[model samples]
Target: MTTTLHVAIDSKTKKAVVFPLVFSGVILLLMMIFGVVMLLGQGKLIELNPNMFYKIMTIHGTGMIGVSALAGSCIIWYFLKQYVPLNTAVFRLNVYLFLVGVAMVLVGIFAYDFAGAWTFLYPLPAQSGGMWGKTGAALYLGGMLVIGTGFLILLLEAARAIIKQYGSLATSLGWPQILGKEKGFGPPPTVVASTMVCIVDIIALITGAALLSMSLINVFVPSFTIDPLLAKNLTYAFGHVFANSIIYMGVIVVYELLPRYTGRPWKSNKIFLIAWNMSTLFTLIVYPHHLLMDFVMPKWMIVMGQVLSYMNGLPVLVVTAFGALMIVYRSGIKWDVASSFLYLSMFGWVIGVVPAIIDATIVINHVMHNTKWVPGHFHIYMGLGACAMILGFMYYLTRLEGGRIDNKLDYLTLWLYILAFLGLTGSFLFSGKSSAPRRWAEHLPEWIPADMVAAFFGTFVTITFLLFLVRFISYSSNIGSKINQSDDIRPSTHG
Candidate 1:
């Protein structure tokens, strides 16, 4: 006699979360291609209208960050559902709001020639120097506010679910067990990470909302005044925290997914709790590091920023990566695309930190702060680190109902993307060493070759990504058939 065990699957809900993730991923791919084109234009490898070049650059910066956050949040949302009940209606609403926001942003950028960078950095959007009008700036700010509203609702819901189940935010953060050592059972690592990230993100969103609102008001009434320094601090504080939280949100997948591949539980322990708790505190203060170059900034605050930057990097990443290494060591795990990306992302996270730490040093920042190195380091960590994790999760999702991976194509795509990404980033780093500035529309003759090399390799990154994206979509479509098949695998265990 043979018996089969079938686990119930929620295909609709899965698709609900997945639709937004994949939609954002598609936009992300387009932005990468556009970014490569912008590089080519800058390098004089191809002729591009300077206005279009800056427009593409502006949209690319803003879109990539937005998509990365959207994808990461969806991944976190999917996993959080297993432990706590979530409102699918609210999730769907968030998706709709995100799409509307994206549309408005594109209109502002492409249709109206808004060239303010992602930071917008106050005054720059309004002072677009005739490149874009005040209406365009208002549209951009309004779009961000809408996006923030969606995120705020989703985050509040997640907090409500976690707190309802875990009894309190402290318990969700695993503080009761960590502080008192009276652990019976606590929320898992994913929950802890999600809880921590959501708390910080909610606060960041509030600050961002205030900034955008004030900017909108100032655009209409020039009489309204905002202190530049205060605005700068608030801007960096919100932007840095929002960006950093995206990485932590992606790491939640690491805590949840890596263990399954390695056949390890990745239990919520005291060390894990402590590391995340430290993260909650450190993340808020680390934004000051971005303001280190502002001369008017208080000296003590600058010093505090430097200290928090070092402290933040050491705890969460170091602990998570070390545990991941230990879990995989001699585990005889079968290598798959999902697992491979997950493991490699850990390396990217650590390696990217080296340049970041160097830049954070006040001495080095004086020379390197405004150079190509800024984008180089951030792209490595974000493009390779956080983005890699989300891509891995995408692979995981496509395979959830037992879809097969195209091993050869997976290997080819992964290697091609990595090699090209490394070369592109290396060019930026080397150019930064030579004091080449960032955000320039055109490069000098000496700088053109480096930009050309970057553009050349960036083209490969875009191609491989497109290939990966097509394969992911293909596998995702047949999940229902695979799930039904999974229900039929029978086994004989007893006499």
Candidate 2:
């Protein structure tokens, strides 16, 4: 007797998958350019109107986060195609909801001239002008809600696929079932569906519901009072976890790509899997660290936040760094630009995680909570780590699409981009130590010589990034015919 396994692929799903990845790369490149411009102006390295800075910031936040969400959903959608055939109806629903949702967000942000940052904190919205602002906010929320419902449907489909493949969700949940009853019959460890994506999606949906509730309350019952503390907690909870979800997606890329490069069989190492799972578990409860500066939050909660923050770093550091290290050390690693970026991404994570861990300390939080140090820590993590990984993946995918390795010019451009980011973000951190404030149009007396030095670095960094932007545009336009067509364009699987 023979058993057949089926996988689905079609033009619509293919387009849905590829469009978001390419769109995100283009958007991120632009965001970095804008960020460099903004920093240059603020540091007095360049002269620009104050309004431009806010506008760039608004665009940067919205564009980057929008891409992050699209990328996350795209990954889920793509992977689901491998196991279960997504119904045409569901696929159409997914695309429509996502596009509409993104449109609403853009309209809302533009409506308010949304300079208040993506955080969209309360009282600021109330202070903004006109019905357009309110409509924009509603549209943004509506879009997300619709996209979220689509995710719910996707999750159910994934769950069904898992059950069909492995008997039930319970069996799929643990190691034994994944290991299988017979040799060569069991799914690979990574092949078994993990709950991380679903869990994160659920949390996002819950947070979105709360945000919607807050928006409705503000609109209809203008006199309705909200506890500032509660509002702050919910907002940070959503923001923090939502940001981390992108990092988790990066983790997914690492898992999928690393072993291929090493030429080793992808092992279902239980410890590595556990570490990934642990990181997710700890991350959900750690958002309160953002609120550590609040005096009103309970002392126990504060302590718990700090503890969770510290603990969370361990699993990420171990699983990502150590896992990559082990793979690289033992394998005949190749040194293409894509792999080079992947290695550098690990360093970026290390740099950001250390400072973030430090900031989680109560003593350190007292000093750095509202300072430039905050951006310093996150820029390395989000801007460099997450964004770098995305770029690496983009290079790999672009190579696949174009049927060749990216040209030498593209490689040179990528290195230049990396150098500029490090210089710009590193200077931002140094300025923070000397008490330079973030998001300010002008510096006060407290700004010292260190700030001046940082400004100089910022100027050079901006120039480097500007050059990078030009190069990227050139590369995108001329992704020529396949150069080396036979090589596996997907990430290496040496393990």
User: Who wins the TM-score comparison?
Assistant: 1
Specify the poorest-scoring 10-residue window by lDDT in model 2: 1-10
Per-residue lDDT of candidate 1, residues 1-495 (tens digit): 322222133666677766786797799899998989988987998899888888888888888988899888887787788788888888888889999998999998888888888888887777777989987888888898888889889999999999899898898988788877685545788899899988899999999999999988888887887987888888988889888888898987788776666556677788878888998988988898888889899998999898778887568898899999987776656667777788888988987888998999999999998999988998889878998898888877665553654478888898888888888888889888888888888778888889999999999999998987887777766653545243222212222
Question: Per-residue alpha-carbon lDDT of model 2 for 1-495, expressed as tens digits?
Answer: 111111134545545555556555556666766766766566566786765576567667756776766665555555456555556466556656767766766666665454656666664444455423556556655655666666566655665666677676444444452344433323443333245555655676577567757755675567865776777777777778767776665655555556556554445455555555566677778888988888899988888899989987577567668778887785766666666767778888888888899889989888887788888888888767877667665554444433445567667766766775677677778777877777766665456454455555545545544543343333443232333333543334332
Runs of candidate 1 exceeding 4 Å displacement: 1-9, 480-495
TM-score of 1: 0.94
Off by over 4 Å in 2: 1-14, 45-52, 83-96, 127-194, 445-484, 488-495
In the order shown, the candidates' Cα RMSDs to the true structure are 3.2, 5.0
What is the Cα-based lDDT of residue 71 in candidate 1?
89
TM-score of each: 0.94, 0.82
**Candidate 1's error at 87, in angstroms?**
0.7
> Scored by CA lDDT, what does every candidate get?
0.82, 0.62
Residue 300, candidate 1: alpha-carbon lDDT: 89
